[model samples]
Target chain A: MQSARADAAARLADMGLPGRRDEYWRWTNPAPFMAEAVPEAGAFRADTPIFADMPKVRLVFTDGVFDAAASDDPRLAGVEIARLADAPQWAGAFYGSLEASGQAPVRRPFAALNTARASDGVMLRVTGRAARPVHISYRQSSDTSEAILHHCVKLEEGAELTLLETGTAAARANLVLEVDVGAGARFHHIRPQGRSHGHRVYSAIFARISAGALFKSFTLSMNGRLTRNEAMIEIVGDNALAHIAGAALGDGADGDFHHDDTVFITHGAEGGESRQVFKKVLRHGATGIFQGKILVQPGAQKTDGYQISQALMLDDLCQFLAKPELEIYADDVKCSHGSTTGAIDETALFYLRSRGVPREEAVSLLVLSFLADAIAEIDDEAIAAEILARLQDWLARHRG
Target chain B: MLEIKNLHVKLQEEEKVILKGVNLHVGAGQVHAIMGPNGSGKSTLSYVLSGREGYEVTAGSATLLGQDLLALDPEERAAAGLFLAFQYPVEIPGVGNMVFLRTALNAQRKARNEPEVSAGEFLKLVREKAKTLKIDAEMLKRPVNVGFSGGEKKRNEILQMAVLEPRMCVLDETDSGLDVDAMKLVADGVNALRDAGRSFLVITHYQRLLDHIAPDVVHIMADGRIIRTGGPDLALEVEKNGYADLLAGVL
Candidate 1:
């Protein structure tokens, strides 16, 4: 255990902190993260839990530390949970390992920082179909606290699991999640970020899929001061599918809010399908960024890939930046990518208003319609409806 | 029921004037057909009346039941019992047709201090109205006008008019993209909505639609003005001899 911590500390020192010179960090500066000091504990009261209406097994994490007394029993049929502190030897294959492996072709220094600094995390293994979703609710009682969490999930052959995540862990948080789906297994992930404007978050997901496996994830981000979410997915076996989608909204007149989504997907096996859909709604000088890439390796025949990133800017003061790239080495693959940024359609707005819909309600409908494509990516209808409700609430609060 | 006095309109972003001192009136239950050549400001009158953007009503007063139509927002104007069937029905990709209709109906009802219609009641009402317009169940479930045929789009507009049940309706080139059969279907839908408490201003470039709609009066529009007003015979004359003779006589 001591040796592993030493190695992680050494790696952290060697990598240091990312800077503006880094190609990936050019659009998002990491100075705030590097200079932030640990915050003191304070009172925090959340208005409502994101998935309160859904049926699930809940796990609570407070102030970056697991709260066993407040959380439900971590025992369920066909599933095993291990606290990282209890078995340090098992950390080699799950912790920092997957994060390190994802560095190939591109480097993510923040994920490494999480590995070196994370004090506690969850290790989950699914041997059979889970009875219900497993939800992890993060709570923060500090005004300026920081949390670094690492979670690893593994699914056995033919097993299925749904994971739901919500809440803001702290004022500033860094999270790294590694997932491994076995042959014929299916995994679904739905997360709605905390609706607090004081948060600055950096999160990463590293996923690997085997033959005939399916992996789908959708994230909804409503409020934050600054947030950057990075995802790297690799399809390692034939006939596998993976989809990653996100919808974000940022509205403020001060220009202090910014959100970014950077994704890299690789098709390493034949007959693999992958899709990426991201949408952003920015108003009142808010900014949004999207940098996505799809790589089809050599000999990856019959691979299907699609990527689209769009932004609806409510006013001229707001901004949207997108960089979509597709690299296909195979000859017989179908791959496409597109990015667009525009304001609400005046013609559609006028059409709705002429039909007796009020101007404000008409705008809200148009905004939701703009985001409908990305929201439709969620396979679970119940969870999709919950997310839709959250989106509507956010629109109602932030609408002009 | 509807009256216009010296209605002058121009493009908001350009200096080109589209309607110059246009005047017209229609009595209760009367169907007035405005026939003219292309760019004769027939559509402009409808747009200006509906409070569409990009048009500056430099001078005019339009009234429905003696209410000031120009002093209200588009939605407010709609709630005041005015409806405009678009020349080109917009294709909203994500909003369902049923949802749009129900929302519009309830919005108008709510603005008039009436209780909103429940889902069951609204669905039943829409189904009954849609049947008369030949709009099947599938069309009502799909997004508004998305991937719909030209005839289907026109029928959808009439369905909206029927559901809203406005006091004054304007049909702007509704017969432009319809075949003979589709035209008859649309005309039938409009004729079904005619009553003593309602009126219609059917603007078109052809006299064929007036044949099915049976307009009580017809007016010839040229260069943004009403050049001639007569009975339904005027539409026949224009259709038979073309607008060249009338336009030459007006100019």
Candidate 2:
């Protein structure tokens, strides 16, 4: 298994990188960035974040390897957290089972590469509800290295988990995450990937939710050179619900942000509800792309889904493109999708200004209002307040 | 404290002129009404005075106190102590009424270098004023004018004007879309706001509202021009016998 894993990594290295010619990689090319991708072993450097009040359990990753010494979070009682000397024990079963299902075959080359080279990824098997939320942080401190991987998380029936995953890299990195939600279980995944300076960041999340289960994931991407994020959630059981919200901020001259989200609610499932809201703020001539699709299989009765994606362009040079599609076969289901891309309302601005708020302050107020719905969804009041403060700070730093 | 001299304004998109060489002046301690039929340019006059964008002032000069009101932006004019109660107040969603009023008031104060009113003080004032106007306190907590009835929206407009306390106020067709009771309440609110230091230009199409508010002077407008000016009896005359007599006399 160890030799096979190493050989897979060697094959991944020989495959080099994905270019625009590939179907999924067509919009965002990662080849020019792959030439600069330098693999490295997990190591740590001393650094303190401004907000130390964040929950303490974190899985720290330097480059692509897992840091067993730095990440001493005892709360993470999952399958494995330490480094892998060889392929994981369930690797063959995990890959083979998913492929035989014939549901979303590994379409992207990067996903294939991640599965081949990823030996240090975490395997979190949640049997039941955990004590507290798990905070996972993957940091890349090196300037010339890439953090690449494939992560698999499985949750059994009646299990509940909250996972806070943040990816920060100085160079190039590609992080791939796969999650399986069991029946009557709950999974909350928060992916905040932004801090990739001059790096290419590509992340894909594939999830399946079972009966009487709830799976919700919020993606907040603010900083990246070339970023592409895709989240696919499949609802296969009755009375299952999935909620996904994403907020992305684009920065830098050549920075490109791309998001493709596909949520599927399979048949034989009744009373399934899904809601998604995607928002992007484009700045500095950066481009933001969002593609969201909701598919309801035949006989998926009583399915309720709502989707809205809005983009605010700060300047004329900045661009935003969005496509929200809905495919429903169930006649009794209620589904709606709306997409809008425009500048701020001038009338609202004048109304605020006439009331005497300065232009910048008025803009901030309007922007906050634009994000009011998203902020209101935070389940925890204290955490919601904390997130609002962080958002204000982020806005001040980026918008100002 | 408000003056409009030879205000000849035309609609930018068409051949119609709304206000033609109309001269009007209102000193403090006065309530003047311009009563006319539909298409008589009463609403256009208020909009022009408020400096709403897209109105071409072909030949006119409007001033507030001694400042050139036409030279300032709409917000700056608002800061300069000019206010217009719109015929159809624009609804702004997601902005609370109290927040909007306080922000507008404080903005005017800030422009004059005055300190902002504390939230507690503003809330107390709003509550008292709202009670007197028969406006529910819950209405003030909602988004401005959104989901509000016609009468409620008009009452809200008056509420804002009272809260702002502008030196010169223009109410454009405030009585058009109100029930009898709502009309009385709104007029009472306006009457309470009237003071020796403030002036009002009430624009309306009917004499019913004038009977309640009691404007000191009445002007009859026809074809974008003030064709006749008289005492309050002029409003009664037009109300008793529609615009037929007035149009006949003018023609």
Candidate 3:
């Protein structure tokens, strides 16, 4: 007899890949995406350790299983971090829905695969409130070759957590993170997807914000061969707010990056607001794509949702495709989406150059200014400064 | 301090010349006012002298402090102690006035190999200058020339010149958009920065501003060249009888 997970995986295999004809995957074609075969079993390493400076609570997962002895973070009190085998009830409720809906209608074949093989991922629950949020770092290096999927965080009522996740790998890796924010809870998730020359990563973050909860997400994508990040967020509660911001810089041949953000402001959720801003700069024949949709259901009045996507192409060979869509079913709601693609301002460039600033420095300053609004949204000034420095470094190396 | 020997220039890509064989000389301890009717190339002369770029110097030579002025870039000319107070200043968004002023000042200083001034010291220096100019403290924190009134923008140009402290300053009708009170404030700020080692070329369409700054020499320009030269009284004569008599006398 086949297990439920096995049955779902077989069903996904029968469906095959999702193609361009699929409505959701219309802009970004994930059917032809290259995927590594799933291994039968894998184990975590106890000797090799990472994230030494953080609050000491680091969970290392190899393939899809947790390493108990290697994971030691005492501050994880008032919260539970367990595997599917340990918490079958919680897993049944969460994974059961995902398993039942695995083959529903998602356009991406990878997302179906994720749901089918959704074992070994962590389920973090902060009941009532927690002392400090756990910091989960997904470190996928060359040693662990199997596809990595292990971090899933959820904050219950009145809970608060700050998650810093990094996708550090030299080989092909697929990471999926699912976060559920309960009523009045706050979640700050930061993902810095570092890139390798020959690596390809597809990461999907599925989050649902309950009533009065806040979700703030920041993503920085750099040095990826072909990286696609998707965030499907649902505002299931009334008066909820979500702010999502991301910045990406692509360089190198065949360096393709794609981002698809689908937000659903459900009906009866009055005073719900969603704001998303994504900025990208393509260089050296690199390609970037952004498809954002804000769906306001019926009775979702007073829902203010705004999205803007801007790109700066350094070379004529560079390409960018930006599609911003707004579907409003409710009246008396303010929703707008705008997209623009152009090169740097030559007049402003000349103005700066006439002031004795070198052409390169002038362009860099302007680019920094262009990305400043996104960077400024970060509450931590130190983190903001670090991101800005990294952005400047990338410009200095690739732009010159 | 500045000399132009038969300088000829044409506005961007134009076949016709604007400043044709215009000669002007200004030494330290001197203020030269060039009054001309419309279409006399007064603004073109300022743009060409400051190396604003896009102008074709068909034939001419301009030297500042014995260095080829036209050969240098705009910032280079500025670092060489040449300043042009524009008739219409540009509004640079997202750049605070103090930040822009400090960056420009530090860039010039760095070019000279001088140590950069501390932020505290720079603020102190700017605050003192702003008080004398009657500029509000809050204005320094706002973006440069963004949403500034006409008089306020003109005052900002003068404030910049004062901070830059160039050896020779060219005022291109800085008095055009200013009221009487604002005009007096602008003139007072320029006069306070005046020194024996610095020269100024004030370009105006009326003798109203001359009554305040009191130019040392006034030259009447017609068509594209200077037709007559005289003391400060020439501005009054032109104001009383208009450029009609002045052009007739020159012809």
By TM-score, who's the top model here?
1
lDDT of 1 by residue, A1-400 (tens): 4454566667667777789998888888887667657433232243455677676778888888899998888887887777767643444556666677787788887887887788777887889999888888888877877889888888989999999888878778898888999999999999899547667889999999999999999999876878999999999999999999999998866336799999999999999999999999999888899999999999889999999999999989888888899999999999999999999999889889899999888888888889888888899888988888888787777666
lDDT of 3 by residue, A75-163 (tens): 47667877655654555456524323323334445665766665566677767555654555555434425554635566888888776
- What would the per-residue lDDT of candidate 1 be over residues B27-98, giving only the tens digit for each residue? 999999999988899988888899889999899899999999999999999999999999999988767899
Worst 10 residues of 3 chain A by lDDT: A38-47
RMSD of each: 2.1, 5.0, 5.4
Clashes of each: 0, 1, 0
Worst lDDT window (10 residues) for model 3 chain B? B87-96
Q: Rank the candidates by lDDT, best first.
A: 1, 3, 2
Model 2 iRMS (Å) reads 2.8
What TM-score would candidate 3 get against the native? 0.81
The residue pairs found clashing in candidate 3 are none
Give candidate 1 misplaced runs (Cα > 4 Å).
A1-8, A38-48, A87-92
Candidate DockQ values, in order, are: 0.77, 0.30, 0.27
